[model samples]
Every structure is written in structure tokens, then in C-alpha cells.
Target: MRDADTPRQEPTDDRSHPAALTPQQRADLIRAAAAEVRERVQAWRDNPNWRNTPANSHRYETTLGAIGVLSELPEPQTEEALASLADAVRPIVVEWRPSRPGPEQSIYAAVERLWRTIDVHT
Candidate 1:
């Protein structure tokens, strides 16, 4: 147990810190989320009902925006880049609701995963 006289010690490994992520980890996460979004987009593209609702259209646009941002992330990604991606997708993350329940949920969940990774590590 630490006592009042004892000094607080810092983590020796940066990865053990609350907000530290390796470059590979960040890039892998971005790639994974982008792939998931792509799959959802494909599924929705096959379903005319997915686009009938106005709310669904907005959500679809944001997911496409997420894909664009994710695609634009440069190699050897930085915290700033991940944070910017998070910022760009924040509205959709907060506002997500599928017109139907299948593919859109997957897209929302994929973006949520990206948000969690960035929020925790960036």
C-alpha cells in the first residue's frame, strides 16, 4: 500500500498508460473499422428500403464520410489523425439509428469501435 510519504510512480511502459497506442495498433483499428463500414455500405446498397427514410440517408452519408476520412489517413498514423477522424465522425456516432436493423447497426458499431480506440488511446 502507498503511504502519504511515498512518491507516486509513473508507468515504465508507455503502452501501459491510459492513453497510449502503438502506430500499428492505430492503423490496424482504422483499417478494421473501414472494412466493416465498407461491408455495411455494400449491404445497404442492395436494399432500396435502407435509403427510403430521410434519417437513413443522413446516416448513410455520414458513414460514407467516415469511409472517406478513414481512407485518407496516411500511413504510420498519428494521434492527431485518429483524433481528427474521431472528431469528423462524432456526430454520426452520437446520432446513429438505422432505418432498418441489420447492416446499419453494423456500421454504427464499427464506427463506435473506432471511437472507443481513439477515445482510449489518443
Candidate 2:
């Protein structure tokens, strides 16, 4: 019988939960999410509507910098990696206002998906 002080355990067979994942598995998922962030950011930058002003350029650089940090993170740093990804995608998630549906929206959606993974699993 389980004691009152003992914690309940989640099923390991459910890969969707982070508690059920090995460190390597979590790192792999974080890497995939980071890759998606990179792809979406690149697409946004490539869009003709994107401006080349200094402020915009700075935002782009900062976001990419965060992604780079996440990419190089070693395994067993899942929380750190997620923090970096969140920082990387903040501009897209919070600031960018696309006039119409385009790469900006794609980038936003990608960021949201990454955060969702963190939320659901973590």
C-alpha cells in the first residue's frame, strides 16, 4: 500500500509526459523544438515585407542568439534549453504584428507549439 508521504507516479509508457522521459529523450525533444524555432525565424526574415531597420535587425539578432544558445546546450539541461527557446521566440510571440497572415504567423505558431510542449510535458 502507498504511504501518505509517498508521491504518486506517472506511467512511463506515456511518452507525452516529461517525468516519463529519459534525459536524452527530453533533450531530443527540445532540440527538435529549437529547430522548428530556427526554421520559422528564418522564414520570417526571408519575407519581403520584413524591414531592415536597426531595431528590427537587433531583435532578429537577439532572438537568433538565444536559439544558438539552446542548440549548444548539453543533455540534462532541459529546463535551461526551454528557457532559451522561450527567450528566443519572445519577440515573435509578444511583439510582432503582421498586417496579414504570413511568415510572422508561422513563426508565432511555431513558438507557441514549442511552449506547449514545455507546458504539457514539464
Give each model's whole-structure lDDT. 0.62, 0.62
Clashing residue pairs for model 1 = none
lDDT of 2 by residue, 37-115 (tens): 7787787788788888896687577667766776665555555554554454444445444434777667666666566
Q: What is the lDDT of residue 23 in candidate 2?
A: 58
Best by TM-score: 2
Candidate 1 structure quality by residue, lDDT tens digits, 6-119: 877633433443355566666666567666666766687677665566876666676677667766866556666656655655555666654446776666666666566556
lDDT of 2 at 26: 61
Q: CA shift at 37, candidate 1, in angstroms?
A: 2.5
Q: What is the C-alpha RMSD of each candidate to the true structure, in Å?
A: 9.9, 10.7
